[model samples]
Every structure is written in C-alpha cells, then in structure tokens.
Target: MNQPTKKVLSLFSGCGGMDLGFEGGFSVHKANLNPIANFGWIEGPTDSEQVLLKKNRFETVFANDINPDAQTAWTHFFKKSFGYSPTTFRLESVVDIVKRHKAGENILPKNVDVVTGGFPCQDFSLSGKRNGLNSHKDHTGKIIGDEDIPSIETRGQLYCWMKEVIEICQPKVFVAENVKGLVNLGDVKDIIQKDFSATSNDGYLVVSPQVLAAWKFGIPQNRERVIFIGFKRSALTPEALEALSMEDIPKEFDPYPKATHTKPVKKDVPEELSETKLSDILSDLPEPDGVTDLSHRHYSKAKFMGKHCQGQGEISLNGISPTIRAEHHGNIEFRRLNAHNGGKNIKELQAGKPQRRLSLRECARIQTFPDDFEFVIPATGKTRKRWDLSPSQGYKVIGNAVPPFLAYHIARNLEEKWNLFFK
Candidate 1:
C-alpha cells in the first residue's frame, strides 16, 4: 500500500526556506566553478527549478508569517516560477491565528503529523541589544535589557503562541529553531521548554536542545541555531508518532547528523567538513551590485563614521562566508567576488576599481538558496537588474530564511529515523 505523505503545519514561515526544504522536489542551482576539495558546486546553473516527478513526500498544510513582503516574495516564487499557487501560505500573525482557531473561525487543520517554525528571535538574540520580550521602549524611553525579556511586551511574547499552536493542533512531532542565544538568555530556554511540554492535550516528551551550525552541514555561511524537538506523550495512532516506542524516545532523538564539511581547526582531527568557501559558491555568478565611487573602503570621514562592524569586514575567498543578516544590506553584506582572475578574492588582488556588495543572488547562494529559486521583492528581485538596489523586501526575506539545504538535511534525518524512535 502506498503511504500517505506527511503534512506539516509551519508557523513564522518567512520566505518558506524550511517549507521548501521539507518539500524536496526542486533541484539546486549548481555553481560551475570547482570546489575546494571536490565536494560539489555551489549551485546548479539552471534557469528553471527542477521538479521531482513523483509526488512530494511531505506537504505543507499551512504556513503563516506576519510580513506582507515575505508573502509577496513567496507567492512570486511558487506562483510565478512553479506555476502552482500555494494557498497553504497565509499572511497572519500566529497570535491572531491561534486566537481565531480557538474561537472556531480559523481554517487551520485540527491534526498534523509535524509542526515546525523558527519563532521570532529578536527578543532573545545576543545581538539587537538583547531586548528579550520588551520590544517597545519604557515610559522612560529606555529599551529593556536581558533582565526584562520574560516580562516584556511586543514580538517576544509571540513565542508562547508556538506552545499555544501545539496545544490546539496537537501534532505528533514538533521542532523549533532559534538563535543560539536562546540557551543563555536568562530563563528563556527553561520557560519555553516548560511551556512547550505543557501542551493542552497530554503534553510532549521534549528533547535536550542542540546547536546546529549551518557551515558544518554543507552551507557556506557560519550560522548557528538551537533546535528543539518534542514527541507526544501517548501513542495516538498505529502510523502516528506511536510508531516510536515510549521507552526509546530520548535515545532516538539523541543523535543527529554530524558535520560533513569542516575546516581544519586542530592537528588531531582530519578535515571531514566540506569547508565550502564563499568564492567557490559565488564566483561563477555575474556581478549583482557595485558602487563606482564608493567601491573601495578608504581612510575617510565616512569610513570612520560608518564604524564598520564584524559583517562589514572584508571576507577572504579561502574561508566560509559570514552570516547573512536581514536589515543591514550594504553594511554587513559581503564584498563582491572578482570571478575573472580564477575567482580571486576581491581583497587579495586589490581590484583596481572598487569592491561591491554581494548581490541578491549571491546572498541567496550563501543562504543555500538555489539559483532558480527566484526572489521578487520591491527591490531588484529580477534576473536582469542587480545593482543600484534600495532593497526593502528582498534582503530581509533572504536573510531571515533558514537555508533550504540545511533544513533538507534535518528533514531527511527525521524522515528516516522517526520510525526508529519506536523500534
């Protein structure tokens, strides 16, 4: 008998990277350039996204995000590129969605095989001033600090909605991803774990959180996120999560995919990691952006005033790319590659003219976004136009997304091993 595809309820699904990874029907854009150690090309050089002939193994029943821009970008990718419209993606705040669902006005499904999301993390991030839950300035107009996260208002409270969704949908499996800072941010981790385990139904058996680095998992960027997984307390069905025996739930979730590609950091260990470099992934592409006059970083008033941060540092072609950020387009983004000289680092040769910021395509590549996976935003989202971008929607969507390739590896592990939890 043919097995039914698993359905996922995705929340805070900005730009659908996790959704696309779980729905693994598309081919990656392979970079024609060579790899550092013959791992693989950055992305495939195809104009159109390749589709899997067989039906996808997993389906997204619902995807929600508060931002209209993200919805627009997602709609363009699916509707314009794939010729299939996904009403599965709805633009609604998770808080409102849960309230409406509880009130019997929402259309979300009552039962789902899995639930997943990278909840709003600005509250618990080490960066962004560690605002925690207090998003708004106080009556004194001072921003709240780490001590105030649990008691603050604003986007920080949205994470509790994740627990609420678990309460309502009562999925068999649930996974949540967040910034690494969540583990150290006061009592945020403990609070969230307790809330997540306290689902309205029978609650769940939560696993110890683990930090997964994107670079360790074939992604070029050095991005790290803490992952949380939970299984329902009691067996619900024969094919449901009950497939995993209660005696072995923790042991099943204990081990995860180890790093396949890594840089040689110590003398004892051989380089198992691919050590995918920025030049290897992005060198084949055409220039996406440039500033003729402001190309080179010079010793000047503006350079001094800009007070460039870590992301602004010039990246070497030989190393992993920096983490991609959402808001800082020109500031934190990487410098453009000089593909002509055997894909030389822009800083190495001191390119005669000037260095430019990475284009949207390059940023997408760093985030493991397939080249064919198009971005249609208010900024330069088209193929022909790359430079002179005042990106409002495009950058945020790309930066905020979980790399599809990274998510794919995680989903693939879940697909094969979820049964073993019972075995």
Candidate 2:
C-alpha cells in the first residue's frame, strides 16, 4: 500500500498561515480549488486562539507560547470549545521545546513530513534595529530593547533558534518564512547558508531563495515574504531534482512571483508583483463611522447608525478580504473609503470619526481570514463588550503572515516532488 501523505509540523506557526497555505493549495482566482489534507501544527504564544479560529485551516498537535495569557486563551478556546487539548508547553522557549524533543523529553507526533514557520522578523525588519547575530550579547545583557534573546527581547537571533529546531527535527522538507529584509541582511543570509550547509553536511543541495507576493496567487493583498526551502538528500534522487529544476518550477521563482494583475501606471510595478487594488479588496465592507472616543456609548451609536443606514457599498459576501493591519483602528488611511474618486474633504470622506477605524472583524477580513474566525477582546468599563485588540497589532500579524494562497501555489508546485523524491 502507498504510504500515507506527508505529515506537517509547523513552527512559529502564526495563526497557521503557512500551514493553511500548504494545506489549501493556491489559485490564480477564487474559482480554482486545490486542497491537501493530513497536516498538524504547533504555534507559539498562547493568545493565538483567535488567529487559529480566523484561519481555521489545520489540526494542531502541539501549541506553545511563553506568554501565560496567550496559553490561557488557547486552552479556553481549543480545549473547552472543541475538546482538542493541544499539548501545551509553557515556560519553555521554542528552542527549549526543540531541545526537549531532540533529547526525547517530549514526543513528536508520528510521520512529520514538512516543518514550516514565519520566525520573528523584528531584528531583520527595516523598522527595527539592524543587529543580526552579533546582537546576542546586547540581548542577554538586559540592554533595554535588546534583552529578550529569541522570545520577547531580542528577535535578532530567532532564526538561529529556528535553525536549531530544523536540525533537531530533521524533517524531510523544511520551509521557513520571513520578511523580505532577511534576504537583504548579509549576515542573516550567511548564517542561513552556513546552517543549511551544515544541515546538508552530506550531499543534499539547498535551493536559492524565493520571494513571493500574495496578489499573484489570487488573494487581494500586496504582501511580500521570502521563503527558504531545504530538502533532505536522503529524500531525493539526482534525477528528481533535475526534473524539478527544469520542468515544473514556477516561472518567477527567483526574486518574485509573476504578476497576475497589472496596472497601467509604470510606478506601480516594483520588483514584487502587483494585483487587485485596495478598491478590489475592500469595496465590499461598509463605510467607516465618524466618531472618535473609547466610550461604548459612542461605539453603540455608530453601530446603530451602521445597522440602520444603507451604507455605501455592498457587503463583500466572498471568502477573500484584504490583509488586516493593527493600524486600522486609529489610522485615517485605513479608514478611507475605496472610491476611485469623490469625497473632497476628510468629513466627506468619513476619514477619522469615532468608529472610523476598521473593526476587528474588518481587519480579520483584510488579512484574508474566514468570517467565522474569532478574536477575544477583553470586556472593559461599563461596556460589557470585549475591547478589540489594537489595530496596530492586527496590522503586524497580517502584514507578517504568509498569504495562504501564495504558499499553496508553491506547495502545489513542489508537492509532486515531495511525493516522489522526498517520500
């Protein structure tokens, strides 16, 4: 009998974007469907329950986070709601978790085929300090913003920890997702190359980096992320690699995905591909409210208005939505309507009213989350309503997540090779 399809173990599995992408497959349009079943996941931070619900993509065998609050949220949601009590590892860092597994302190599920993650990008981000690996001292020395090493403190060396996990797990295929800046970091690339070389100390080869845009794969967002794929030598034949390199590899595999959507303007095309406009992404959401306070009274008034008003546009009524951002809660740009024209003034445009920011639901939609997925907001003051998380946090999460559709394409392209050569 043929062996069961490869099992997956996801690391830094933020809301399971990479996991979902590999599981659902990718498409150029909404009509196309490709689904891969039989995968499991592990995510850090206990607070990922909302993220998991939003993606609603894969089964999780392991979930871990250093934050007690995040773990609490996960246990409450997954265990209490679905009776799926994921192995919860608290106190231990990701590296510690990997080490424990390696030393046989904890047992991994059977037949883990692929390991994936979008590791922390703070140190490698343009907005963050440019400290690469050498920042470890600063991180450990309790140096203000640099202390927390791989977890909350210094994220510079987080990739190193991820590499350790890959080394210890030794899965057949390992996939890493990170900000595009990672490829630009000379030291980061060097470290990856070195670790990859060591991982393949035998004869296996590692392919070059591939940067992909979500838009080209059918999602409406314009997010770009870099992917590093390492295949084990023992899992592949020379002929298979040759076949993969020549025949089936995607056309725009080097620096970006091919542009499936284009604009008439030349300035629009960067090294990354472009797709559906903001109008295309959010045309379906309702108009923003014109209030500006933290009071539930204000929010209630706005909600009442929204419910009664005809609203400008039709509800999206589709599965896809634009990527959500944390800034949506307070930013004028995020609140602005998608009209190609009209609305001369801020007031006319509904720019910064009280409830002007995108709701958590709207933010989730923008990030391409399914409608039924939920986020837990704490109830505050006289308003028993849970206070939605900061729009900035939403932005960070969505901006950093791998677009599932795009990931699906890469996985589909690689699936045959995974089955024939790796298996």
Candidate 3:
C-alpha cells in the first residue's frame, strides 16, 4: 500500500479554530466517541493554550506571532502544558517569515497536502472603515504605528502575502477564509482572478467563493464568512476544470445546510420547543464581577462573583446566539437572573427585562470551544486562578474565528475532492 499523504499548515491561526475543524476529518477521541481525524501537523501562534487542551495529537510545527505579549503567553502556556518548547515555532513577525522564505533561507517542506488560514479581515470587512486596498488600521484597530505604516504597494496587501505564501509553499490545496465582505472589496474578484492567472502553475483553479453560515454547521453562532479554495493547477485535470466550468459551481454550493436549532422570534411558542438560547450556553457558567481595573503589564486573575445571571426573555436551546461584538456593553448585555428573584436559575426569572451580558465562558461555548478548553490567566505561585477572562478579548477572538463546524464541512468536501482527483 502506498504511504498516506500527511502534513498541514495554517496561517493567521487565531485560537486554532480553523485547525480544529480541519482536524475533524481524522478520527479523534471525543468524549468516548472516535470521530474522523484529519490533521497531522498544525501551526500558528495565537491562542496556543486552547489548542494544547485538545485531546488530539499531532506534530505541532511552525507557530509564529508578531506580538511579543502573545508570544510570551503562548510560550508560558506551552511550557505549563507540554513540559517543553515547540520545534519550528518562531516568535518572529509574519513579514520576517515571508522575507526569509523569499531569500531562500527557509524552504517549506514538500508534499504538504493542505494549507489553511483565516487572514486578518478588517481591511476587507464591510462593517469596518471600507478602506478596501488602502486601510491603515491593523486587524486589531490600533492606528498603524508610525514605524509600521505601509507604503502604497503594501497597504491593504495582506491578501497578496497569503497568495505569496501559497505560491512558495505549493501545497496541493489551499483554503483562504475571510469575512463575507472580502467578496465586495473594490474589484477584489477581478484582482484575484488576475493574480491567479499570472501564475505559471498549470491546472491551478480557484473555486468560486462560498458564503457559509456557522449555524448551518454545528456551531451555536450565526457568523458568516467567505471561503476560497484553490487546487494547484497541476493537481486538477483538464476534464475536471471543463466539467466545473460547464456545471455552475455556485448553484451546486447553494442552499447550505440549515441550523440544527432555530431561534424563535416570538414568545408565544412553547418553551420546551423553542430553539437554543443564551441561557443554554450560560446557565452553568459562573457569574461575573464588575471589576475592570487591572494592569496591562501582566496577566491577572479575577474571581467570579455572582452578580447577574438571568436569560433575557424566552430563549431557545436550538437556535444560534446573537452576533458577539467587542464594543457592545450596555444594550447587548446578556440577561442574568436578578439575585432578589426566588428562582435559582435564569428560566425561572421574570420575563421582559434585558438579560445580563454573557460571560467569557458562555462566549467560548457559543463559539464551539470544548468546555474544558483553558484560557490563559495570570498565575500566582504554582496555581493558575480562573480570572474572569476579558469579555472584549473573548468577543474579539470569537467574533474573528471561522465556526469550526462550517470549516469541518468545507474540509470534508475538499477531502472528498482530493481523494477523487488523486485517485
């Protein structure tokens, strides 16, 4: 039997959400059940703690981060969990990685089957400044530092960097994910086609962009993102492209699967039959204290004090959560039970008032993170106390991630295509 092809890499990997979804293709032990496994190697730097908590085992290679604070947190977590440092992981900036690779100092490994990433999307987000190819803000919204501002050639050019990495790595298949707004960026579609056309690699065909909803997959959020898949021109046969061109790819991709649970718009429906609600994701979560003073120089742990814990009006367990936002605080507060209420839980609380804001754990749950996944907190001596994770950071990470279930479906489809093409 021929050896099975193995190896995968991810870029701009935030909290390993995309990596987890793609890894679902391989059989993994999940709470006593073994699911199909997919990843053999994973890379990227953000949220390494969450990735380390996963039961799946694979060679983790090539994690990178530009932020020193993020790098420090990642290293601390890796040391605490794995007892050693990761090989091939770098604390260097991504631009430096590209430059080194371009200089022929770092050659990517061969026969890598897949490359995936959720590149920074602020420049391309419809909800953002609409700067298109000239945004000066980084993904995190800080004004571009005086020293880091880009020239016209590099402004809003991160997508071009992704394209460069793909060209250099030459993976059999690549998946680039971004906000749905990426499709509308000034002449982006034409630019992508033009860029791909310029490559000499044969049979490389970019799949039409797919707008996928997280709820359709198993995630309990209504996030939508655009996914672009490309097969090396050499990997696709002439017949496949001919067939794809003839058959309208978008038509086949439409009518995406429906959410397993749908949220109810009215309170008249029976509570038992209502779709999933915020309470379902947060009922077991501890309450949050209103404490917000902490030094930014070091990680600090905060105690979870029972402040508010009630669900806003009637909620369903079957539907998706409202979109989590970083800046939403007052109106968007998730409802929590009033302490004065005799009821012990949110469901028993009186209806009609706005719910308390969602806790970080609840946000994580809604984002489809496993209940046991650990978020890094400040450590005191040897014990790491559970500080109330920052709601803003949680919101940013959750808001930015591609729903794992959506990624799973996309990966599964691509895997099928790989088998068919390589057979």
Candidate 4:
C-alpha cells in the first residue's frame, strides 16, 4: 500500500532542516543509526558506511524564512534533492505572510496537514541574552525603531505569528520548536503553550511541551530544543483525544520519538547503545586543504579569546560536540586547540595540521545535514553558483537549523501512528 504523503507547511524554516527530515530520503553516517529502531533506511558499505533513510510520508508544500542566505542554501538543496521549484519556498517573514494572508492574499497553500516552525530562538537561548518575550528585534531581525514599542512582531514573540499561521491553515497538527532555555525563563513556556491551546477558541489540544536532546537521536552535538505539539481537536480520533489529554501520555499514543542512542551515565543502561562520537562522524574527512568540498574549504578564522568565553573550548573527538551556535567569527568553537591553548587531538597536530575552528562541513555534519547539503560557497570557485553565501552566513544558518536526523526521528514517529491519532 502506498503511504499517503502528509502535506506540510513550514514557517521560520532556516535551511530546511526540519523540512528535509520530515521528507526523509537523505544519507547520513552509519553511526547515526540504531539497530533496534529501524525506520527502513538502506545501509551502505561496511567500510566508510552510510545509511540512506527512506523517505517519510510527509511533503513540505510550503516553506518560509526571511533570511536570503537561508533561502539560497535551502533552495539549492531542495532543488537538487527533490526537484522542488524555488517558488515552493517563500522568502518572507511569517508576520508579513500572516498579515498579508489576513488581508485576503492567497499567500498560504490550502490543505496543509502538518505545520512546523522553529521560531526565532536567540532571545530564549541560554547562550544569548535571555530576552524571552521582550525581544527588541523586529520579525526581520532588525532592531525595533525607538519610536515603536516591542510588540508581538518582535523576534521573541514571533511564535505568536506561527500560531497565527496555524489558525489560518488549520493543519491537523503543528510542531513548534525553540531553544531549551525558554523553559527556564519564567513561565514563558507555559504562556506559549497556552497561546497555542487558545487557537481558534480552544480548537486545538496541545500536549505538554518537551525538550528533545539531539544527542539522544544520534546527532553528534549537545543541542536541545523544546518542542510544542498541538493537534486540531476536531481532527483526532476519540482514543487519541482521550489519551493525549492525560497528564502522562500512554506509551502507545505518545508522539515523541524514542531515544535511539544513549549518553554516558554513572550507572550503565541496559542494552546501552553508546552515543555517536564526534570522531566517528568526522574521522574520514581529510583536513580542509581548500581542495575538498566547498563546505570543508573554509572555516571561521576567529582567534581564540580564551577559555572563559563561550566557543573557545576545544571539541572532544571521543565525545559529542558542544552545541553549534548560530554564530560566526570568534564564537565558533575550535576543531582543535594548540598545545599552548591546552590543545588536544595531538594526532592531528603531529600530522602537521594547523589549529583551526570547525569547518562549515564539520558543523553541518554535527547538525546531521547530509554531506551533499553545501553550506559554504566562495564568490569565485568551481563550486560557486549564482549564490554568494559567506562562511558567516553558512555558520548562522547551520546553527539556527534543527538537526535533520533528529527531525527524521520525529517524522518517523508521527508517520508510524498517523492513523491512530487522526480520523
């Protein structure tokens, strides 16, 4: 039987990570897979192994983001992988899109099944200023004019716009993602959840939000994001409605994906599947000698400011990487530090490679974007196309993205029980 594709509308979609994961049909390192939780992906060769994940039952009918570089990267990857027309991705702010939509512009597609958005997270990110709902930047990331008051249009409150899209599209389901720090910032998580539940006169039943750790889903980064899932009450079956309303969701009806890999703990876990190490994913790549792929050829050249500051620490090869920040310049962590800088990865140093920050390719791999998803592009190179995205742009987009591999797990979990949840 042919599985029906769920039409998805993506908002605030930077570089299409969630879109790619939901659509599925991408290659990833073998270490990113679990033997117990097979999603019907094709395994590659034992030597330098990879896994080609089966396409999911979801299709992104529409995608939107304000960032031009994100559009460039997303357009390039989507066109190459799935033959999607550039028109499928709208380069507009959700706020503008929603306002135009409210004004009777046919900007949004009809019959969207799933709505997904990782709304602007910087304000709520622990690594950031923790602005929460009182952000000073407008929807396009520009600072609000001194004359204008910070309102729902501000970056921190952009999820409200995403909520607005949900009200307009009325998808059966909607998934909103944000930085984990939102939970710590004084009832902000509750406020967002409540706002989502209030959609269309309490038309949606929102499950309690949960923070998903990327490392748990085989991503080689210590990234975590809180996810909010809301189901259109009228669209759900009776059992699903009852099950989902419970304080503790029954395992059979839980929408969250099970953890595929385990992190290290003091006590051993049964059948403990070790997490994928950063080294396992990156060991095969030759040093960025400017002769390899476009992503590997360039990296952040920000000098280390020392250990006290963020992004100055060196990544441990044997362990997962620190969270990839949506930052560039001096904020990108070093791939290796020199001896004077408390350097590790002595083997690379001995091999005569220079101390450098993680390359665009390395960061993308850590985020589980396939090797083919080019992040960096030089203005003049054989790999250069019509786009001129700099390394800074690459780092920003990559850091802002949800890990596609982690999104794949969410997609598969939803796909596996779609019928059970919906009418």
Point out where model 1 deviates above 4 Å. Answer: 29-56, 80-86, 137-153, 236-255, 266-272, 289-311, 336-353, 377-390
Ordering by lDDT: 4, 1, 3, 2
Give me the candidate number with maximum lDDT.
4
Better of 2 and 4 by lDDT: 4
**Can you tell me which runs of candidate 4 are displaced by over 4 Å?**
43-48, 145-147, 266-272, 378-387
Per-model lDDT: 0.65, 0.48, 0.51, 0.89
Error of 3 at 229 (Å): 0.6
- The alpha-carbon lDDT assigned to residue 387 of candidate 3 equals 39
Clashes counted in candidate 3 amount to: 33
lDDT of 4: 0.89
lDDT of 2 by residue, 1-423 (tens): 543555566666554446556654211222211111212221222242222311222344554444333343344445544465556324345666766777877555555566676766655665457565545432223344444444433446655666666566666766777776777888677576567646733433456767666555546554567778777666666655664455345443321234345432588564233344444444444543442322211211122123223232222323333333222223312233333422223443555423233454444444555433334335456875454433334344444556555666566555534445553
2 or 3, which is superior by lDDT? Answer: 3
Worst 10 residues of 3 by lDDT: 27-36
TM-score of each: 0.77, 0.65, 0.68, 0.95
Model 1 lDDT tens row, 1-423? 665778899999888888887776555534311134324322333453222212236777788897776786676666654454668788877766877778988578866888899988776777777756555543223455666544322576666778888888888788898998888888878887777877778878776667899877767787899888887766334433543334444544442454566666767654444466777665665443352221121111112113235444555667777778786444545453345423346454574534456556667778877656555333444566443322545677788898887777677667766665532
- Decoy 3 TM-score against native: 0.68
TM-score for predicted model 4 compared with the true structure: 0.95
RMSD list, candidates in order? 6.8, 9.5, 8.3, 2.3
Model 2 spans > 4 angstroms off: 1-3, 25-60, 63-84, 88-92, 136-154, 200-204, 243-274, 287-332, 337-355, 377-396
Cα lDDT of model 3 by residue, 73-92, tens digit: 33443454444364434655
